[model samples]
Target: MNTDMTRNDFRTVAREALLAAVQGLVLAIVVLPCGLAFVVLTLVSLAFVPLGIGLLTTPAVLTGVRALADTRRKLAAQWCGIHVPAVYQPLPRGGSPWTRTFVLLRDPQVRRDLLWLPVDMTAGFVTALLPALVVFYPLQGIMLAAGLWRAYVPATGESTWYLFVPVSGQGTAFLAAVLGVAILAVGWRRTPRLLAAHFRLTRAVLGGDAELAERVRVLTETRRDAVDTSAAELRRIERDLHDGAQARLV
Candidate 1:
């Protein structure tokens, strides 16, 4: 029974790690490129705002930026249970495009979103990619040990590398495999924490102390609600036992 429970625990950990890896890859590949592209578009549009051509276009582009930031906030909450409330200053209704564009430019949340884009594509990109790489890179060395090194060697008859171990022959291949397995064993348990770090990194940029307080406030409210719900449930169950069972006995 103990052995089965241990295996189940490890299985759950492994599954969470794999999901984190995939999430990291998604942030690295799709989110990174889309964010950078949006930034470029926004900058280009801003450059033309003086010409009256970008008055409308800039706000449209900014809408995309807002959407992207909101998506990040949603992911942060869903993936890592971090609550980053959207605190944007609402746009005044019926303003001219010129007025609205500048108003968005002046808003603190909008400014942070713009600032975060560059950071996200760079530091955020690497942080998001590292968990997946750490989990998968060891597999290459293991594959090399399984006779993939011969395929790795070129026609020039040169040796290939696997984690600093040169795979010149079977002996080196075995060494590489040992190193790979060691790494995998060590890092597998930490994969979920690594992805959690990625979300926290973005949260640092997207929301700071205010967001932390908000998250805490939300958690307290949720806990209170849960306690209240449990109390109500207990009372209902007691009433059922009293009215149904005691009435029959009486």
Candidate 2:
């Protein structure tokens, strides 16, 4: 029974890790082009800001940027159980294009979203792709081990390195397979964690815990101030003294 349960646990974890890895592959592919488009549009629109064309276009582009970030937030929450809040300031309605443009520019969240685009394309792209790579890359080495190296050696006419093992013959190919199994052993433990890291990175930039922390800080300070004010009022009441406003009224 214990052996059966252990096998079941392994199967469950492997299934979850495979699903997450594939999901991350999809995310990585989608974010790359979207991030590039947004980055180019933002730069082009901002360049035209002085000419007034950017006044309208900039805000629209920024709205798209926010939408992209929000979509990632949704994906993070829905797919990875990571809750990232949207904390953008509301833009004034019925305003001129210039007013809207400046309003977006003034928003810190807009800057954060802009910052996240490049990062999503670069660091985020890597993180999102890593889980799939970790989980699947070893399979290629195993294929090489299983005589696939012959097809490659004739085609390439040279020795190919399979994860630092040179695969020119059966013995070397077998060595590649051993390395592959070693990598698979490591990946089995890390695939789901790697997938979660991608979403965690998204949340870090897209207002996850920082926004909550700031809100908590503000609430704490407000509560402290209220307590101090109440204590001061009680002290005055005990001493039968009136504050400035009360004394003036009396």
Candidate 3:
């Protein structure tokens, strides 16, 4: 891909991921009260068995974490134009339910995803703060400008109009305002890049490539073992038939 195009793709992916995150956050905030209520109700029903509630909470939390990881992977593939192989292998049917559940719990990718959820949430929260400050600070400044102008402009003391005019108070305020706006704009522009960097860093630290290589190695070993076993079985069948038929003839 062209470097610029790749960057653009990454940006699009980042935007989608961020948007998803924002949506998740909003949903969490909105649903948190109701969720807590449900938990309380469950606890009451369970006679306040704290352990039971804790057990239930674990799966719910893990499920949410997995969803976030899947969303990230989808966004990465669709927008960032990076293809990552699925880390999960389905088990054959006829296995016991417990065995299947155990296999799922042991999956490295799922564990990594569980670990990443909190980190991603933290990063998203921090990234959001910059934009929030940018919006709030300028509005505060505007409010202050009006009051400051009225209070000091007609006073007999040192002239303060320099604070607002091209050569006065107005000029100084304008500069400050411009600086604030610049900071806000820069923060908005860099949010996507920061998100992309976080995604890449997490993938690297979590051993994504190592996991993939390990899976490939296991597959190769399995194929080799199957071939060997098949050859041995064939040899045994041939020997048995030959020995039995010859002995009977004798």
Candidate 4:
């Protein structure tokens, strides 16, 4: 891949990923209240434990699912470098809440995203763990090793140590520490690229020909609307001239 293109794509994907993370965090936060409410409702139901809990948790779960789906949609757009329509298809006229909910549940995009969110979340969590481990574990091990070396290395060893004494064990430990730090630096540097690649893969798998066709259709309609608007304005101007100035002269 072109490095510049990849960098640009990473920026876009990173923005969307951060937004998705925020959305997930928000949904997770919102679930607390909903969970409490569910608990209360379940207590009141007093029977059919599974069904009661399911009914009570449904709203929050559905909200979370939708938020995740939206995140995926945005990520898909960023990854594909295409603008996904933000506007949802309007509900059918006089549709009831149940009908709308059912329609959403049946939406291909929503189902795809619902299926993907857990995996995405897992990927994100794993990615995050890499830096933490690469940084913290190495630092911790180095500190422990250094302390052990310092305490245990014979202070009066080798005739009170030469001016440029090179302790083999200490040198090996220092090299290992340096290597760990290098690994961490490299991992941190590569994280954004990894994330972007994952996002691209996700977009490829979840984005279909139908979605692309819909986007093209939307763009076509938008251009047509713009042309019609310009023509309408010209007609209005002509009508105004004919009615006002031309008619007054006649």
Best by TM-score: 2
Ranking by lDDT: 2, 1, 3, 4
lDDT by residue (tens digit), candidate 3, 1-250: 6999999986785565455445434433433343344434434533423445534444444455555556666655554455544465455587654455445557776666645545544553454343344334554445434455445545544544332433136555556456555654555455445445544544553436656667787998899999999999999999999999999999
lDDT of 1 by residue, 183-222 (tens): 8889888877887887787778877555555576689889
TM for every model, in the order presented, reads 0.81, 0.82, 0.53, 0.44
Relative to the unseen true structure, what is the C-alpha lDDT of residue 58 in candidate 4, on a scale of 0 to 100? 43
lDDT scores in order = 0.85, 0.87, 0.53, 0.51
Residues 38-106 of candidate 2 have per-residue lDDT tens digits of: 999999999999999999799999999999998998888888898877667678989999999998998
Cα lDDT for residue 81, candidate 3: 53
Compare the candidates by lDDT and give the number of the best one.
Answer: 2
Q: Cα miss at 244, model 2 (Å)?
A: 23
**Model 1 RMSD in angstroms:** 15.4
Off by over 4 Å in 3: 1-64, 82-85, 92-94, 127-176, 184-189, 205-207, 214-218, 221-225, 228-250
Q: Can you tell me which runs of candidate 4 are displaced by over 4 Å?
A: 1-60, 69-88, 131-137, 148-175, 201-210, 216-250
Span of 10 residues, lowest total lDDT, candidate 3:
159-168
Q: TM-score winner between 3 and 4, please give it.
A: 3
Better of 2 and 3 by lDDT: 2
